[model samples]
Target: MSASAAAAETPAATPAREPILSVNNIEVVYDDVILVLRGVSLDVPEGDIVTLLGPNGAGKTTTLKAISGLLRTENGEVTRGEVRFMGENIANMAPEQIVRRGIFQVMEGRRIVEDMTVIENLRLGAYTRKDGAAAVKRDLEMVLDYFPRLRERTGLAGYLSGGEQQMLAIGRAMMARPKLILLDEPSMGLAPLLVKEVFHIVRKLNKELGMTTLLVEQNAKMALGAASYGYIMESGKVVMDGTQADLLDNEDVKEFYLGGGGEHRKSFKNLKSYKRRKRWI
Candidate 1:
């Protein structure tokens, strides 16, 4: 082929965008023993939603703690590798320091203070902001706009419904004006409808506000629906990583996670666990 013709036939290279958050081959240990996460690595590009999914004890939450620097509080430490946010290594930094650096974690449970009023709980998220009360107050109004139910819940946060409490937790994270959010099971314990609503809000925040998120979730269906990219973990290690469509369309994922197994596959209890383990391991 002619040089010009050959050049024209070649595909153009798509420039790679730098990730807002990068976790590289990190290992975590608890209490100077009990190794947890094993070389888990992933990336969250700016304004993108990524999800980490697995069964219980897959180290999903531990990964979040490792990135958010909460591991130290639990006597857990990132023994190897690095976590970088905006190109700066933040692994093992103080939780407060990580928050100030524009990363906020909405922990697994709705960790809102039951004793405080809903508004007070939201304000607590902005403790690291140097901006004056005016900016904080504006953000407070913005949060209420996102979760209008919080407006009526001026009383103690303890009284809100489970879904409402979940909303409060996210709204509180919004109060931080963070660059990235680490969400650990936002849909946990919610009804189906509430799960739908929460995912809708999550999508809205990502699309409208350009918020970047790294989500750890057990609801594979919902997580895959909301996230552009996904990682599936098993026993503290990432076993699979792919785009949403890739995971949703995968035979193993459809069978195991989405409840669409073949006729030959019966209930999980009837199956040898090793049969499933072999697929990922």
Candidate 2:
């Protein structure tokens, strides 16, 4: 082989960036008896979007709650392991303390205050910040620019559409200027086009604001598209983790998450053989 061809075949070395958020070997239990997360571990590198993808009951939401210190609110607790953010152990901290530490979670449903106006809802997100009115005003302007549709909706949050509420949830999270955003189910109930638009904004935030995100989504295909790294969870465990290319090329991920695209195995033996081959699960 030619020297140039050999050099091309050799992979380039990558420099490692520090994790903004780390959930290591965590086990979350609720009401002291019901265990939800089992030895879950994942990392969100600075300035990159890392997605946590799984089925409905795979403990994705629980993991986010555990990291953000919201678990304690619902009689949930991190029974084992540690959740560290910006190099500090935050597993035992309160939710408000966690928010003050630059990590905010946009909850699965658009949990805006129904009685409050849209701008009032956005201002609530900055409750943790010690910034002056000028800084808060600037951040509000930035969020409005990102979600132009929100520019006019000063009415009550209950009056907004489902898609608009999702947008408001994200914009509210951004108002905190969080270093790491735990985004849960951003594409939950929106139309296909709206999902596309939300993911577009997600990518834009990462690229423009230098934001780091840990996204939890059942929409694996859409999540993977926005993510640089992906983790697949099942039955409260991380069964597989890899880069976007690694995940997108996996036949199991394609069949299960992205929807199958090719012919099925011909026999039970073939199926059994392929199951064995799917070591990632």
User: Please, what are the lDDT tens digits per residue for candidate 2 over residues 36-93?
Assistant: 9989999888888889998888899999999988898899999999998888989968
What would you estimate as the lDDT of candidate 1? Answer: 0.86
Position 204, candidate 1: lDDT: 85
In candidate 1, position 252 carries an lDDT of 78
lDDT of 1 by residue, 1-281 (tens): 22223223222222276888999999999999899998999988888888898888989999999999999999999999999899999999999999999999999988889999999999998899999999999999998998887898778999888899999999999999999999999998999899889988997898789888999999888888777788999889999998776776777787777676465756657566757666553
Q: How far in Å is the alpha carbon of 200 misplaced in model 1?
A: 0.7
Worst 10 residues of 1 by lDDT: 6-15
lDDT of 1 at 83: 98
lDDT of each candidate versus the true structure = 0.86, 0.85
Q: Give the clashing residue pairs of candidate 1, or none.
A: none
**Candidate 1: lDDT of 264?**
72
